[model samples]
Target chain A: MRLSTKFSDTIHLLAFLQVYSDIKLTSAVIAASIQTSPVVVRRLVGALKNAGFIDNDPKNHNPRIAIDPKDITLLDIYLITEGHTPLFVIDKETNPLCRVGGNIQPVLTNIYGEAEQAALTVLNSKTMQDIIDSLIVHNKVKQAKEKSDLAQDA
Target chain B: MRLSTKFSDTIHLLAFLQVYSDIKLTSAVIAASIQTSPVVVRRLVGALKNAGFIDNDPKNHNPRIAIDPKDITLLDIYLITEGHTPLFVIDKETNPLCRVGGNIQPVLTNIYGEAEQAALTVLNSKTMQDIIDSLIVHNKVKQAKEKSDLAQDA
Candidate 1:
């Protein structure tokens, strides 16, 4: 199975929100940043809003999304936007005749829960704000390099 | 997006191999345990062999698959078989008119690598053998309880 881009889009959107906290980031703006469609961004934002990862004013002509980057963990955002099913999925029909298959589902479910918890343990250690902070620093360095290059050309 | 049954099937296949190492496990037995067609089991077994996760005889006659469960990590097996793409998926087309859209793919790729690595770090901790051991213990307890229930009925 392939990893979905929705996960990365959510991450980028959260980071952008953190950097632009003073101003509301529209779905169009986020879509531009991620090079995706506004509709896609809106769908993700909807999920984020429902999950309490972000807030928006639908009463406004064009809704503006405000995300509390500090309050949100990557895990929370992941669960909200891109994480739908259990971490590990078992799609095949288990063998009913075998003792193992008859009971392995519950056992595997328990193990998958532990494994997912372990994965989340690492993800919880990171905050969306931290990712945003790093991105801001990266953008600053990039701008500085471009300025230095222009100066050299002049 | 979803976990495939390949991981569990691989584990069960390995355990069966360990138990009947001297004998070749025909697709029939594996299919019986997997509750699928022998053709399906053979196909999966073929994929495992191609990935070097298992070894099969060159002759099609009663091909025996040898798996070193201890040497194989679930992450390794997954990467070989099901881990070909990014961890998350994005289904929408990126906007070509936007600069971010033009660059989003590469940027996401870099970030995806890091995020996937973090995920892999957790998956790396457990091997298929470890899961099999747990299954064995669980199965034994269940069997013992069933036998007791049968005796109590008498």
Candidate 2:
């Protein structure tokens, strides 16, 4: 009954990857950064890997997944994780007797397909780097405030 | 953890309502068409009603919710059934002791907010009528096939 939280999780992971693009981050680091378990990160990474949205260095013997932040889009992650399912879901068992129910699937599928495409269209507009840039700006603002606090103390 | 199939269900329901806009439908009828339990229809109707997406006849006292297809949008139905959760999901718990985890919440929240906004932008682009139009077209195609089949039989 819940909308999958993976879509949100993927965004969080992407933000971290974008912020730490230069560093080889371990799953533990991502897990820590996101306040989640490393096992969870591994699961998400598997999906992202299958979708070719991320690269994992098992050879480095590290659990870190290297992300090409520039190459990653929110849609890239969403499709790998949450996007495969039709944007709208219908029950496998619909009333067979109702003409509408009998015919609704194909009809609904077409409609949902369009709506989902619309959803993806919006998702495609934002990139991992855009999120990272906002974070950097936030950090700068925080640093500026901290400097002001120190000056007041002096 | 999965996106509830309810939005799809609601849309299907509404599309049928759009087609049968003049009819007073019962939950049993809707459940029959949707091939789900009547209770499920009632539940969805209760939500749709609360969201002001539809009106059930107070006079009929039947187990039906009257829907106003013109006033409803796919986005309205989606948010109603899905609640105001983010389009993406994050873990409920991350290691609180990790500095990254500690900071990740606000950062991720901000990003998730933006990502959700992006998703909403797409979802908001279309209305219920638009979906119905697509459905009607699909039905016409289906009817044409049925007619062609009848002709072949003759």
Expressed as tens digits, the lDDT of each residue in A50-151 for candidate 2 is 766666545554333355566667777777777566545666677544555656677656555665666576567767776566566666666788799999
**Top-DockQ candidate index:** 2
What's the CA RMSD for each of the models? 4.1, 4.3
lDDT tens per residue, model 2, B24-137: 677777777777788998898788767676675466543233544455566677788775655555666654543333345566576556655655565566677776776667
Model 1 residue B65 CA deviation (Å) reads: 5.0
- lDDT per residue for candidate 1 within A112-143, as digits (tens), equals 67667766665666676666566655556666
TM-score of 2: 0.73
Interface RMSD of 2: 3.4
Q: Which parts of model 1 have CA positions greater than 4 angstroms off?
A: A1-3, A18-26, A56-67, A147-154, B20-24, B56-67, B89-115, B151-154
